[model samples]
Target: MSKKVENLLRDICFRIKVKGREVLKEFPITPAQFDLMQKLYFAGEQTMTELSRMLGIAKSTTTGLVSRLENEGFVERKRRKNDKRIIIVVLTKKGEYVIDKVIFKRIEFVEEVLKDFDNNSKEVLVSLLEKLNNSVKRRGG
Candidate 1:
C-alpha cells in the first residue's frame, strides 16, 4: 500500500513537471534559470554565494545564471547598503510574473484533471495530502 502510494505521488509529480516544462516553452528561460528564479521568488533576495549554496551549484555557475537573467530583465544585482562589496540578487517584476504564470498554469492543469472529483472527495484529498506533507516534514524530508 505504501509502495503504491509512493509510486502514485512520483507519477503525479512527473506529470506536473512535464506540464511546467511545457509552460516554460512559452518563456525565454532555461530550466536552470527558472529554478534560480523560483528560489529567488520564494526565498527573497540572496547573495550569489547563498544562491550557489541553495542551488547546490558553484559560484561561477550562479554568476553565469544571474548574468543571463539580468540580460533578460528578469533579475538585477544590487549592492548592500552597509557593504558595497556584497551583491544581492533581486527578482524583477518580470521574474515574478513568470513564476506566477507558471504556477497558475500548473494549477489550471490540476483543476482540469480533478474536474470530475466531487467537492467532498477533493476536500478529503487535500486533507490527506496536508497530513502526509506534515509527516514528511516531521521526518525531515
Candidate 2:
C-alpha cells in the first residue's frame, strides 16, 4: 500500500512538472532561472552567498544565474545599506508578474484536472496532502 502510494505521488509530481514546463514555454526564462526567481519571490531578498547556499549550487553558478536574471530585468542586485559589501538579489516587478502568471496557469491546470471531483472529495484530498506534507517535514524530507 505504501509502495502504491509512493508511485502515485511520484507520477502525479511528474505530471505536474511536465505541465509546469509547458507553461514555462511561454516565458523567456529557463526553468532554472524561474526556480531562482521563485526562491527570491518567496524568501524575499537574499545575498549572493545565501542564494547559492539555498539553491545548493556553486557561487559561480549562482552568479551566472543572477547575471542573466539581472540582464533580463527580472532581478536586480542591491548593496546593503549598512553593510555596503553585501549584495542582495531582489525580484523586480517583471519577475513578480512572471511568477504570478506561471502560478495562475499551474492552478488553472490543477482546477481543470479536479473539475470532476466533488467538493467534499477535494477537501479531503487537500487535508490528506497537507497531513502528508507535515509528516514529510517532520521527517526532514
Candidate 3:
C-alpha cells in the first residue's frame, strides 16, 4: 500500500511539473527563472546567497539568473544600506504582474483538471494534500 501510494504521488508530482512547464512556455520566463521569481515573490527580497541556498544552486548561477531577470525588468538588485556589499534581489511590479497572471492561469488549469470532481471530493483532496504538505514540512523537507 505504501509503495503504491508513493508511486502515485511521484507520478502526480511529475505530471504536475510537466504541465507547469508546458503552461509556462506561453510566458516570458523560463522554468528556472519562474522558480526563482516565485521564491522571491513569496519569500520577499533576499540576498544572492540566500536565494542560492534556497534554490540549491551556486552563487554564480544565481548571479546570472538575477542579471537576466534584472535586464528583463522582472527583478532589481539593491545594496543594503548598512552594508554596501550585500545585494538583495526584489521582484519589480512587472515581475509581480507576470507572476499573478501565471498563477491565475495555473489555477484555471487546475480547476479544469478537477472539474469532474464534486465539491466534497475537492474538499477531501484539499484536506489530504494539506495534511501531506504539513507532514513533509514537519519532516524538514
Tell me the tens digit of each residue's lDDT in model 2 across 30-64. 88898899999999999989999999999999999
- Give per-model TM-scores: 0.92, 0.90, 0.85
lDDT of 3 by residue, 57-121 (tens): 99999999999989999999999889999889999998888788777766777888899999999
lDDT of 3: 0.87
Candidate 1: clashing pairs of residues: none
Which pairs of residues collide in model 3?
A: none
Worst 10 residues of 3 by lDDT: 18-27
lDDT of 2: 0.91
Cα RMSD (Å) per model?
A: 1.4, 1.6, 2.0
RMSD of 1: 1.4
Off by over 4 Å in 3: none
Q: Please give the RMSD of candidate 3 to the true structure.
A: 2.0
